[model samples]
Target: MKIKTKSKKVNKAWLHDHVTDPYVRLAQKEGYRARAAYKLKEIDEELHLLKPGQLVVDLGAAPGAWSQYVRRKFAPRDAAGGGAAVGALNGTVIALDLLDFEPIEGVHFIQGDFREEAVLAELQAAVNGRPVDVVISDMAPNLSGIEVSDAARIAHLVELAVEFSQQHLRPDGALVCKVFHGSGYSQLVDLFRSSFRTVKPIKPKASRDKSSETFLVGRGLKQQA
Candidate 1:
């Protein structure tokens, strides 16, 4: 009888790549909660997406890096006397995801599915009926590796993000959503165009070149309210 050993060569390779990745090291150095911070930071730098004191909403804000960034930008400061003073025009951020997140200052975290009406209602309440200045959605479906199915699911999430933006975004507000290049991408882009004055597709520096994921930045949202 021969005994066979299983070599976790692939797992080792993955760990090696992750450990050596520059973004991972940067995240640690910068005190970010996750490496995803670089992704949004790169996107914002290129797009000029976020502003101090602008109300923002974060979709799929788990692990809280994105929330942390938004919170810092909009976090309230103490006034001269003692009370909290308005920082950045008293900007507000509402962060939502299916998984619960530890609270970040200036961010109201809502743990729920965005597709649910109750969740949307909760998000609306968090916004307090104020039109949002920017909406950033990094939602992705739990990959099943069935390309078509996964693409469709992610596309649906993009749709929900767009719908939420329509209801919550102010005139000239912007939206950034992560979408995969497959199945219904074109249709989704078309919808975005119809709702925004400018819709551009972007592959940020932090995004892996091998990955099909990209962000759609929709600017100048049409205000129905």
Candidate 2:
């Protein structure tokens, strides 16, 4: 049928594009888990989100390229600061996801749905009462082929990330999360504005031009009166 043919064509086009993308080739060359590492790299260059000795939580951290980048950038080095060993890194990274991901050297990974209370509790316990300096979320719900429904699902995940940051992040900490620009977008921005002293939206160069996805960085959580 025509529908099947159209689907096949679309798949082929995506495959071709993936094969040719400069970021993909660069990721392979650099040993990153995926091309998405470039997207986070670009954002971090602008924001300086990762720092030495920071405790970070990565939500929806499957495929773990972001965590890998964090480890390489902030992981504690030997006294000489010459080696790339993971366990000696200066900071801690706790990554959570619904899907299984291959282990990263310096990252502690938890597998579970982030929306559940039990999972949240486990994540908090993993932090072990440490003040989280940064929380990053790149979670996206499985699309149902309905735009509105998809938007709502993604929005809910964003909200959960925001709420978790509000509760767990240090007063001067930051949150970086991936969000789409449609439907509940404005409300999410407003939520960030209300909770943090500064909120900025970033669209990294590595992100696909046709995608509506953007990163929201919320910095300096306001003290509750």
Candidate 3:
């Protein structure tokens, strides 16, 4: 009974916070699928990583708020198309996730586990030989509440994103990946430093104050990696 009561209280607290979150209200007004779009928007505003006509790969892109944000960036800035959804997209977006998402116009969707070789092959095929201008990963493994295990899971996903970036991103392209600040965090930072000419860690205001998540942006891959 105590466990159930505690769980219920936690749920209520989270619900209240979500309802009161300004980002959530703004997302509803802007037609984004989730509040997460603001997080990417803030990061892009800070870094200027996204641009028109770029080919982007989105990893762990379920619920697709980030993709929606990118779509808006690619929206043509003409009288009829400016800031409109499904209007003349000036870029390419390919999104992959373990869970299926509702279709977004002008975005290709793939459903698969990213850790598998076959899925990676399919993702590459979808790229269709174009040099990716940016790769963004928000992938995080399902947490089991074991700190060590969770940290390893997070590190593995980040590492895979790095490897993919090394193989597919343009020499001057960027990779943005979500990583938690805990065990193995420094090692991930070191990995980024070794792989990219520039690395930055960004925590967006849309992210919850208590969340450990931060984004690592790696740009301009170094040779001999």
Candidate 4:
């Protein structure tokens, strides 16, 4: 009973912090699905990751906030003299997640476990032979509350994301993924270094100050000599 009370207090504290978070309020005012949109937005602004007419794949895109940001960025506008309709962005966004996601404008969603070969094949089919310009993964495994176990699970997902990027991204394509600072972090960084010509680690301002999560942005895939 005492443990339950303590858990409730922790939950309430988290809820309080979330409600008062500036990004959360901003997201609500701007119609974004979640505060995560600001994180992507900050990353995009600094890295110039998204461009018109590019093909992007989003892994672990649930609640559709990341996809929403991509859609808005590429969505054709009259000033650009591009396609004059919603979802008519000069680009395509293919989103995949293990959980079912609500639809987002101008995004193709695949529902399944991304680690499965069948799901990977489906994602490839959705690409329709177009070379991917960028791949973004915000997927994190459900935490087991054990630090070592959690870090291992996170590392596995990061490995899978990197492997998928290697297989599908164009020679000059880029990858951005979420990772935590813990066991296997250095190895994952080494993997990115080997795969990409330039690797950068970024922690967006919207990311919580207390969180150990950071994003790795890799650009210019290296071709085998």
| Candidate 2, lDDT over the whole model | 0.89
The digit string of per-residue lDDT tens for model 3 on 1-225 reads 999999999999999999999999999999999999998999999999999899999999999999999988999889365666786899999999999999999999999999999999999999988999999999999999999999999999999999999999999999999999989999999999999999999999999999999999999999962
Model 1 quality (TM-score): 0.87
Q: Name the regions of candidate 4 deviating beyond 4 angstroms.
A: 79-87
Itemize residue pairs with steric clashes in candidate 4.
none
**What local lDDT does model 3 show for residue 19?**
96
Give the TM-score (vs. native) of candidate 4.
Answer: 0.94
Whole-model alpha-carbon lDDT for candidate 1:
0.82
lDDT of 2 by residue, 36-138 (tens): 9998889888989888789999999999998988888775555457226355777898999999999988789999999999999999999988889999999
lDDT of 4 by residue, 67-156 (tens): 888888786766356423253667899999999977877789999998899998999899988889999999999999898899889988
lDDT of 1 at 145: 86
For each predicted model, how many residue pairs clash, with residues at least 3 apart or on different chains? 1, 3, 0, 0
Give the higher-TM-score candidate: 3 or 4.
3
For each candidate in turn, the TM-score is 0.87, 0.94, 0.98, 0.94
Could you tell me the lDDT of residue 98 within candidate 1? 98
Off by over 4 Å in 2: 76-87
Residue 150 lDDT in model 3? 95
